[model samples]
Target: MSESSDRLQRRSAPKRLTADDWADAALAALAERGLAAVAVEPLAARLGTTKGSFYWHFANRDALVAAALARWEEVSTERIIRAMETAEPDPAARLGALLRGATLSVVDDPLEVRLLAAGDHPEVAAALARVTERRIGYLAHLFELLGFPAPEARHRGFFAYTSYLGHAQVAHAVPGAVPTDPAYLAAVTAALLKR
Candidate 1:
């Protein structure tokens, strides 16, 4: 090795990356580069670290993937669920507020927009489908409690749920899409709530 190379190698510090670091990098990679680009080397590079640090923090790639999903569930789904649950005594109002807040937040996530646009990430696809299903179920229950028949409640809930997904796509796709705007979102949502 050249003198400078030898000196640089000798001067390298020991790796000290933690699990949270790896998870953060992994999440960013998933949201930005799509899942395929999130291998150990790239994530380590994104972290300004190395693969050794990743292996130390994660058992393998799957573990990292699980961690990323868990983090999303914690911050996104769980938080929204809590907010809606606590919003009010009225289910419609509470769910509406939650959906409105969610739409607004999702509008700001360009990375999420791109990731969904790319159509990769089977894991996220499956997980989000489940999340959507649960949300639809919640809507159904709420409508039922509001005095609608079960079938009608489910029908309206499905309509609202699907509309939200479509609106989310538009919000992420159109250059100036802002379906998340509170007043606009309320108007759109109020229109959809009709059976």
Candidate 2:
């Protein structure tokens, strides 16, 4: 075989797909086509692989869905919270930053809206519940730091979270109406953080 043929053969060889790759593809499917779209065969086709590759990583479709939700929580919620904690030491500033980040763009965070829509599914419901509790708890802690009483802090936390959910839902519904301006985000952050 000539050198060019060898190079062409190497380029045509299949790339090995990992569990993360499957989970990521599943997430994209979930975001684009609801949770029902996340199937082994469809995802395998999307990845340009076979069902065998999926089975190599996950036991079944449910397992892949669970993995995708876990990955979403890790990257979207946990990672963002960690970054905020590190970047903003002041509780007020941290809360403002969190609100600003949450309201950044509805289109940019379609996965969140998709997950909310899939909340009827057992695994999706459980994952949503866990994420909701975690986010509320963190926001409550920040409120406490800002000197609010425990009950009040919890109330404020719920308010903030619900506001975010409402905004996300609206944005998803009418993508064009949702403002992406920094001033709009700042105004939202101020309103949410107001005692």
Candidate 3:
């Protein structure tokens, strides 16, 4: 083909998908189903693309899984902490806000619970460990700012994190079992923030 013909063909071609696009689709699959659902062909079909698009961004399914996990960690943990820090000025209030938000929110796909169930997978396990530590550490810092000593702060942080995990699991596995009303959320926050 002539150079002009080649240029025209390239210009008319479909836009290439980015790695983030693949990672996001993979994460949606992970959240909806499980780690097992993050296969290349299925995700490609979901994205209305081909396996060639998947291979262009990720070496294999494991790499795609890792990328999805990383995106989840960044979105679910890091950005949340940042938002909490910015949104609340008082430490105790921040902790309470965190509790209320976490408890009252309704998620269609329980990504955390799904990842926890898939914890046996190596990528999921590693990502879970990192997110667990980071979340608990941030909670501990907030507790410390609220006047709790380091050890006490850490313990309370762990307790708070576990409470969130339990809430997520209950909300996902058995909807309507846990009360998500404002009164219930307030009670839970009051109990958690009790000195």
Candidate 4:
């Protein structure tokens, strides 16, 4: 092909994967095969690229893992919280929505379970702790807004969080076991909130 033609072809080709892309692929790998599966070579293959592409964005595997965890935190916790707050003005409704949203499992996004399983890693542990605290704190605040005392709110928040975690674990272990019906979820929310 002529020089101009070659240049046009190259320009039209897909752009190189960004660090975010690599991190996303790493998170997918982590979800599919646990933490150990998040390696440079495998993720590169998963992305239909090479290690060179990964190395361009990350210094090493650990950096990639950290990036993936950070991305998870942003999407799973921060963004969810932001969306929840904006979606509902009432604290009680927001809390119910959060619980319902959390219980609905997304097949492609099972990173929470994977991360909890791999929580021994310092990065995973730290991320898990941050997310757990953030979620529980928000829940507690909602409970307080609903007229629960500070200690009682915190206790209810912890109970709600543990129930969530347990439900997630059970859902993962036994598909279709965790009820996703709106009525069931409403019942769960009402029982948890004691409303």
Q: Which number leads on TM-score?
A: 4
Clash pairs for candidate 4:
none
* Candidates sorted on TM-score, descending: 4, 2, 3, 1
Relative to the true structure, candidate 3 reaches a TM of 0.89
Candidate 4, residue 46: the lDDT equals 84
What TM-score would you give candidate 4 relative to the actual structure? 0.91
TM-scores for every predicted model: 0.75, 0.89, 0.89, 0.91
Runs with alpha carbons beyond 4 Å of true place in candidate 1 = 1-21, 111-122
Counted clashes in each candidate structure: 0, 0, 0, 0
If the candidates were sorted by their lDDT against the true structure, best first, what order would they fall in?
Answer: 2, 4, 3, 1
Tens-digit lDDT track for model 2 on 1-195?
999999999999999998889999999998888998998888989999999998899888999999999998898889989999899999988998888778774557688999998889999999999999999999999999999899999999999899888889888898777776778877876776676
- Superior candidate under TM-score, 1 versus 2: 2
Lowest lDDT 10-residue stretch of candidate 2: 100-109
lDDT of 1: 0.72
Q: What are the per-residue Cα lDDT tens digits for candidate 3 across 96-122?
A: 888877766634457788899999988
For model 3, name the residue pairs that clash: none
Model 1 agreement with the true structure over 3-64: per-residue lDDT tens digits: 99998887896557777678777778777667776688878777787777777778899888
- Candidate 4 lDDT over residue span 2-104, tens digit each: 9999999999897789989998988888888899999888788889888899888989999998999899989888999899889899998998889888888
Best by lDDT: 2
Report how far off residue 14 is in candidate 1 (Å): 11
